[model samples]
Target: MNLQTKIPLKPNTYNQIDYHSKVLLLGSCFSENIGEKFEYFKFQKLQNPFGILFHPLAIESLITNAINEKEYTKDDIFFHNEQWHCYDSHSKFSNASEIELLQNLNNQIRSTHQFLKEASNVIITLGTAWAYRFIETDEFVANCHKIPQKRFSKELLSVEQITESLEAIMSLVKSINPKVAFIFTVSPVRHIKDGFVDNTQSKSHLIAAIHQVIEPRNHNYYFPSYEIMMDELRDYRFYKEDMLHPNAIAVNYIWERFVQVWISEETKTTMKSVDEIQKGLSHRPFNSQSDAHQTFVKQLEEKKHLLQSNLPHIIF
Candidate 1:
């Protein structure tokens, strides 16, 4: 008898990810988790340059600004908590110096514009449909930056709104890079702060909107990441200490499933070698000056050189 219900996942027959493919991952912290895997495998990838954007509107805003090469001006940012912050970006971009923040934001946007033009696969992981609209600016904010809750009104994006945002993202990116494929997935992390019922509603809107935009002819597809978490790994054991985020075991399991579907079979052997090198590099010897340790270090360097020779873009 089957122990658990598994989402039926099949490897993509075309547009599979290889070492050569430049992957651009945007959106939620869950996307960061997957991006970490890509990094470990030394795949050519760029993730969350502006930081983890949760909603489609935030992602849409980011793509729009990046495509247009929006330069951050003094009016675009505010001083709060003794640091300069932008309403459209994660707090990680906040800087004590206004000039630094502006410079960083503009530079990242410029680079993102160039990277998006060359990216082969764009993976977007939608975290939530719920968003905060800053009443002062009368615009949706990606993060509230610890501002008083009363200063912003929480709004749940309707399916139509999310669909439009997603369509705009695809259109904007495709205008510059016509052949790029979009792999959209809903994040599995539960937003318990939104309340159990509200979280479900938010996820429902995201799912509905994503389906409306994903089509074979459009070169867009959906992966059942949320379904796999809720169904295949339904137990609380899969959750972390907070009882919300997926634990390492769950993350690894989901990653394996993703690899099964997305990673190219031709590149798996290279991934194995990369994994071996990674493990070797991380191995700590008891005696640093020992001949054995020196030999190991030299061998590790040789492996790195060989791998780098084959994939010039990959760096340890």
Candidate 2:
């Protein structure tokens, strides 16, 4: 669990599995990306009714709120096209009745908790400790601007508070489903707005809290997503346009590193073949909009020829 040692660390990332795995992803938006990658890798994804966020409190709030009601919909919980549910194309918040919306939210939470109970391995990608909280209730919210920033103020969680919250979450998870194993990871994406020193301190505190909580326990463990990105892939070139989330190439690198830890050698070979094909095609030059389709065709033709020799069979 400790980044230094304890959880038999992988050199790059965890290994890819030959057969699809039934995984439930919790934690931040990074978990959503991981889930997307797992699907891309052909792993069977278990649906989570709750949306992913940087904090568990947000997830818990959604679920708790939903459970108290009866109706449900994906829009009641998930983020779509970078916009939160109510904030998306439809401002359902303004149109939907409170009783109906309340019920939908409750059902979403109940479904999510049920999903967590059945998940074989729960991957939790914690984003940051800094969050905006509602001033009246002292409850932390996901996006403060949804209700106006004046309603909520920013709060920085102490190391002890984070530890306590995580411990409580662990208890909840175990209480509902004793068989599931938890895999913790600190998201490497920087929170440039959290103040450089404070953000750094927050991450350091999280890493320490994770190790302290899980090291003594045999079943719970952590994966070094933060270390892999921060230490191994230090170059800023790996980042995307936002410079917050890792670029596609960087994500591939991180996923590869994760595969090294969990996937078998045979599975690794298959993944490598697939990845090579993708990398080879993604680099083709397209000078203008007109060239895009033609370039794609050329890439496909090149791929076809490349595959003709020493062909790699995808059994699954």
Question: Which regions of candidate 1 deviate over 4 angstroms?
Answer: none
Candidate 1 achieves a global lDDT of 0.94
lDDT of 1 at 143: 90
Model 1, 164-267: lDDT tens digits are 99999999999999999999999999998999999999999999999999896768999888999999999999999998899899989999999998888879
TM-scores of the candidates are 0.98, 0.69
Where does candidate 1 have its weakest 10-residue lDDT segment?
216-225
Q: Residue 89 in candidate 2 has what lDDT?
A: 14
Error of 1 at 152 (Å): 1.0
Cα lDDT of candidate 2 equals 0.63
Clash tally, candidates in order: 0, 24
